[model samples]
Target: MASAIPLTRADMKRLADYAKREGVKAEVQIDDFIFRVSADHPPAKVDGSEESELDRELMEFDRKHGYR
Candidate 1:
């Protein structure tokens, strides 16, 4: 399991400053290259196609069973 690290006030300030100066996002997220305080890329997108397909299949099954 990966451990979590708390960001200090200075770190938050730097990130906020960078975001404001660069016109990036206001969202503060720790990515793979965490603690950059000035990372140029946005956070990676999470893929949920498999989960969505499973949900659709489950919905279809429920409809077939008159449970929907």
Candidate 2:
């Protein structure tokens, strides 16, 4: 049972506007004086077309160290 904080109309509108600009879903929750805001966004995709030099070196090191 957490404490909840009361937010004014202006505060709510500001938060909503921020969420809209970020292109993410916003969630707000209040519990016993606590106000929480969270954003949900998809994970970024990685390019795997070619192995970088550092990647190749790390792989070689892992093979030598017997790190599966």
Best by TM-score: 2
Model 2 clashing-pair count: 11
- lDDT by residue for model 1 (1-68), tens: 77666677787788778886886765555665355444467677866998899999999999999998
Q: Per-candidate TM vs. native?
A: 0.33, 0.37
Candidate 2 lDDT over residue span 1-68, tens digit each:
64345788788777867876786556665554443444556698766644476798889999999995
Model 2 lDDT-worst window of ten: 31-40
Candidate 1, clashing residue pairs? Answer: none
Model 1 segments beyond 4 Å from truth?
Answer: 1-5, 26-68
Residue 61 lDDT in model 2?
Answer: 97
| C-alpha lDDT of all candidate models, in order | 0.73, 0.68
